[model samples]
Target: MAIYSCFLGKNLKHLKIRLHDIKLATHNFSDKYKTESNGHTTWYTTELSHFNKEKPSLVVIKHFLPGEKDDEEELFLTELEMLTSVKHHNIVTLIGFCVEGFDMMLVIEKFSNGFLRDYLGNVKNMRTLTWEKRLKICIDVAQALNYLHSEMEDKKIIIHTTLHNSSLGLDENWGAKIEDFQWAIFLPPNNKDGAMSKITYSNHSYYMDPEYAKTGMLKRESDVYSFGVILFEILCGRHADDQIYLNGSEKGLIHVARRKFHTGKIEDMIDPTLKEEIGRKSYVPNRGATKDSFYTFLEVAHQCVAEVQDQRPTMKVVLKELQKALFLQVSQLYILS
Candidate 1:
């Protein structure tokens, strides 16, 4: 209890913003201030009233969802606790929060580029993430996961259960900022674990770790599997959501990768826009991404998405491989070209 008191006190002292201030900052919660919402949670952008003629800072406001009062409140506190405890550059920043009346909200840094799901949704937007940018996005999230899995000295193994495209945000510089920790869980170091179920059982299966799904023993490697799904999404430009599976057979990224990944037809899986980008380069291996770069990248993804959890690489290992890929692609990657 003393440990928890310390964390709660630390968080509140620095992060408690008055509800009146938030209302004023968000223009009385006007619709125009809203940037995005998915029915459950809504996001608004605004800055706190200036104390010093400083530039009007932009920030994001996440309205805690309203529902069955008891469950929602518990979930809200859990999420708040985790956000208050864990802070990282790659993960979205929490500026403050408000709990007034029926409204419970978390204040976080706003990312101008929105969710990574945005680009992957349409072929037209695929160009927004050139091959170079795509690799960097993966690297960004990989490092973020590395932090969640091992870098936090005291936060234990924080597992993000919903590590999908929509949760991966992009800031003004187009870097990755992982968010949506409402489903995250914290456990002792390297202890396989699962969060108490918050949603229906079926909805929880989408980003689940298969072994954990089967054995009910959640491991950090579960995140590795989900990251593998994201890696393929970057390479193939598609959603790994169960909707894809429900719509067709042998069409999901995992299905396609399993059947053809090592059979020399894996090249078919690369999104055409990315292929065109690579084709623009005269040298097969531009800077660092060789013609076989997709194979190598997907190879890592393959290991990550492996059906057996034990086969998955640690997030650290995943980040290292991604770094090597980024170095090889440096010549053709975003900054240089």
Candidate 2:
């Protein structure tokens, strides 16, 4: 057995220790990573190193249950290899990994601000994420997706099968970083004839593309559809699966958003947590500052989440649009400053 000590950047002392050492430090591996009632993986907060510690990091230790299938082990190794190969500013970094016995552990860089879901779901944080911040986050995620889809030569057309609010992390600077690549799929090589090129697993109902879910077809367009849902979530400050009050009845946010968008009542979809000056309350604002911003954001969200997947813009295009929106916002801020 070979023991490897890996260091991040130039610091050799801040290396990630082996999983055996980690298990000893924490004690009770099963208690460390308990399974949730829903059967999804649940990680303990104590497993992660303190952010203020020297060369702070996150340790994700997942234990495979007894009689785990071979497919599960393959999936874990594939994900680790994929993450280790790619390095981008907006993509989460894999510090190191250990596959000792039945335990699989991944050490990754820690993001201080938590996931995008926390900011969007919490009413207080929703107001804190201004239009400027939201636009920046959209641009960041779009750039990351674009890199995955086009720029990377080895893994071109990489599909993040799971794209949701929780998979997006926020750094201390509030910039967005795409995380959790365990479900990612890389397209087959050009010379591999008849080789399977895509993966289609059942995704979260809210984020799953109708076309892909029905036909088991995996395409770049599927990512576009999920991106649309994320854009709508950002604009409306509601989960895709959430129900909203609309037209004297409760309906899913998607339904309400589509109807309001078609009827030109786009402003109605804005989250109520935003200030009246930011255009959430009244149809007509005296200053018109919030009204214009809200409408502009709504228009982008509508384009992203269009019913027809073909009409949706690619991540590259989306990134450009978001950057333009951010520039405009910054210019306006400069005038105010």
Candidate 3:
């Protein structure tokens, strides 16, 4: 109660924005301003008029469609509260929110590169990321998770229930930020085993933690499992829900990836574009991962998607391993130059 009250008075008041101003900025949520809508939520990009800066500032507007008023309102408030409480360089910045009338909108700083999910699959609309950039992006997300899990001002741990591709966004410099926190939960530091009984479920089983699915308990390690999926997605250049992974008997990237790893055929799973970079013999230095770095990343990623929750490493360990992998790649580049 104290935690909620403190933020409600000190933060929410200053962060609240009027509905009229948002209407003006988004031109009444015009199609021209709308970037995307996935049925439940619509995203828009516009320069907020009330800011009144010399240069127009771009911001992302998330309009949560109220299907059943009570449920949608709860989700909106959960997201708002989570965003207001958490702060990190690798987490999306919440600028303001409007909750007047039927409108439930959150205004956030717009990232230049957009969602990480956009760059996945065979889509040529987005630029391909170098292995170096991918490693850095993973590191950024790992850092954010570590912060949420251990570094909160209140001695509470946050479990980001839905940590999939869509939950991650990339900035102008390809830096990654974590978003979409409506499903996140907080647990007291003294909670047994740092886990809580699950209250909700996600349909995306590909990213959902197996232990949580089976036992109805959600642990901080659940996020580690999901992050592991993202790591494999980056390495294999495919989404967890991709049709290719779904059609096979193995089903899902985690199953197929682990099988390949055990059979000593893990190299088959590396993205061809990355393979090209790795195999290149040019004297000029490039951004592809060296064998040592690739193996380091692969081993940790493999460990992350382990079936047993206890088998997975903590976010802190994941961050340390990713940093070491990046260092190995960069040091090799220096030697080559």
On residues 230-333, what C-alpha lDDT tens digit does candidate 3 reach at each position? 99999988888787887753458988888889999877878876765664554235546787788889899998999999999988899999999999888888
Over 1-337, each residue of candidate 1 has an lDDT whose tens digit, in order, gives 1222444545386677778888888878899899777666788888775332477568888886677545555556667877876878889887777776777788888788878778875888876677668888899999999999898976577978668787899999989989878767887765654444333224435556667666766668888988888898888787765465445453366766666676867667677766654534454323223444555576788899888988899999999888777666663454444
Steric clash pairs (candidate 1): 193-218, 288-328, 288-329, 289-328
Q: Which candidate is the best by TM-score?
A: 3
Clashes of each: 4, 0, 0
Q: How many backbone clashes does candidate 1 have?
A: 4
Q: What TM-score against the true fold does each predicted structure earn? A: 0.85, 0.79, 0.92
Q: Which candidate gets the maximum lDDT versus the true structure? A: 3
lDDT of 2 by residue, 1-337 (tens): 1222222333433434566666653565556454222233334333444334455445444433323456455555556656765778999876656565666556665677888888766778887787667878888899988887778876455778778887898988988989777778776643221223344344466777666655666666677778878888887787776645433334356667787778877667676654345633433312223445555556666776666667777778877777766665566555555
The order of the candidates by TM-score, greatest first, is: 3, 1, 2
**Order of models, best lDDT first:** 3, 1, 2
lDDT accuracy of residue 333 in candidate 1: 50
TM-score of 1: 0.85
Clashing pairs in 2: none
Worst 10 residues of 3 by lDDT: 1-10
Candidate 1 residue spans exceeding 4 A from truth: 1-8, 50-53, 190-205, 241-247, 277-281, 284-289, 331-337
